[model samples]
Target chain A: MSHSSPASSEISFVQHHDDGTFKKTVRKVTIILSVVTIIELLCGLAIFKLGHGSHMAVLMIKGLVTILSLAKAFYITSYFMHLGDEIRNFIMTIIVPLLLFVWFIAAFLIDGSSWRELKNTAAGSKPATEQVEKAVAPGDKK
Target chain B: MSSAAIPAGTKWWSGGKSPFNLSYGKMMMWYFLMSDAFTFGAFLIAYGTTRFSANYWPDPNHVFDSAPFIHGGAPLVFVSIMTFILIVSSVTMVLAVHEGHNMNRKGVEKYMLWTILGGLAFLGCQAWEWTHLLTGDNPVLVNGEIVEMATTVKVNPWGEVVPGMMHNGHQVTTPGPVAFGGFFFGITGFHGFHVLSGVVINIIMYIKTRLGHFDQRGHYEMIEKAGLYWHFVDLVWVFVFLCFYLI
Candidate 1:
């Protein structure tokens, strides 16, 4: 129950920690996260300055900000969550599942774009209804 | 204490103790956070898909332009403040966890108080933003009439910019993609809920710390687990800020 107790045989490692260095790393990570967030904010402002018409330039900047945001996420999860100092196999268990997002984002965006294309090109569809129609009972409708 | 009782060849993975070199509680917390990440990921991805489905989506710059007490405010100013607030809270939380490790109950209490204050500040900002958006009138040309509208779950007024109509210095716009308002409120409201719960958890942790609960337990690992949840909140905000405010 106390720090004075010897390293228990139940746990494998004898943790050797220095108070000063731990605080130092905390400070370093905090500053890094702040700077990265500032850069992201600047990118947002740049997008505003570039205006709406320059599609390519605006897209590029948005991509940059997205990457920077990912970096910020990494810092928070790794340092603030202390996952970086955790054992290797434990870290893998967390990181490996997150990789699922790559395919998840891609598939949704792709299909969404495709559906838009289909909707716009189909001219034979009935005009959009202005009022909702009541649903028919299963066997009552002719 | 029983190191000699075990067979000499017994490996960590052979199951006498945690192979992860961590407590079950911390490992379970990690798994919980991973699942939470997927939840937010699905929300954001759904938002993106909805965005792609629409031809005339609202630009975030125009939509988030106003700040409190600043008429005709600049873009990204207020939201940046919100982001920084969450970030600062996260830092305080990590410090609290560190104090817990060192068995400094006073230090932990101090940092926990600061973290709670930060969470409440962030919530207050969110409340104002939501209120302003919900009640502030912006004129829109609907059915050949300039009808006033506010951003709501069912409607968005920051549509494609209309050519030449203005009322009280607010631009008239065609109705935007309805899902824009839906996603904005739904996702942010969800994130705010997480922040709310995190604050509550931190409060409980603080009260227990005040009562010497962690001291009795001896490890302060409870504080570490709560710290993980708090940082996860901050981590989600990073992406939420990107999805709603910046891009």
Candidate 2:
């Protein structure tokens, strides 16, 4: 058991004091994450301001935001969360569920096409507003 | 030199350390973080799908508008403060872990209390935000039109629906798609729940530390575990910020 253990004084998940690199890694990435976040916020503001109700602009903003978020997540998992130093098998175990989760999202997004069809259906053609107003007006009859 | 003896009833791969060892606590923290990761991932993914699939999703700025507050006309200042609070808590957590390494019980308690306070404040802000969402905007705007009916007008200032309105978009006098409300409630609500649980765990650890439990054991694995979970909370917030605030 002792042989299997890295060392009584060894750092397994993080290697900061041994070479003092871990703090640098976390600091560097945290700065990066903060910068990216600021940029995304600016982009979000610009899209809302300059895009002028353009659907494509909305998509662009959403895409940029998601990309920046993924960057931060990657840094956290690799550094702050210390998955980068984990064994390949352990990393893969984490990766598998995440990949599956992405697949599930893809499936749902595809399924959401059904929503478009619903939007075009006779029932959905009516504005959500009119329906509510009508429903309330009738209820008021009582 | 004698090899260290593995504790009884423990698997060879139980980190080859006692279940009560610092290493074991670290591993357990990883497993718990993994589960938490899945939960947050699911929420973000679902939010993505909803945003993408919707015919006309409200702009994030419109959804989260900054408005002037009564105090010095401060508008939407809390979000910025919330971000900083979370970051400070993260810093305090690192300090706590550092103290744990030195086996400084009082230092651990001090930082732990600060971290727990930060967490509570975050939760309180979340609750206020939720109430604002539910009560302020009944018929928030989605596209250029209103979905639900509210007593007051809501505006979208970032040219989302139209400039110069509330952040959740202009509150129109129409009913919104229930699906929109459902996703909003589910995703943010779920993240808030995680924060709540994290706060509770930290509180318990704070009490135990105050009682000198870790000092007696000659280790501060609980502090490390708490640090792991606290870091995970910050990790997930980064994602939520992107999905809800930026995107």
On DockQ, the candidate that comes out on top is 1
lDDT of 1 by residue, B1-247 (tens): 0112333564877675777766777788999999999999999999999888777788788888889877555899899899989989998998898788778999999999999999999999999999989997889989989988999998879888887778778778988888988899999999999999999999999999999997887667788888999999999999999998888
Tell me each candidate's TM-score. 0.91, 0.72
Clashes found in each candidate (C-alpha, N, C closer than 3 A): 0, 21
Go through the candidates in order and give each one's DockQ: 0.40, 0.17
Stretches of model 1 off by over 4 angstroms after superposition: A1-10, A14-16, A123-142, B1-10
* Fnat per predicted structure, each in turn: 0.56, 0.26
State candidate 1's DockQ: 0.40
Full-model lDDT for every candidate: 0.85, 0.64
TM-score for chain A, prediction 2 = 0.69
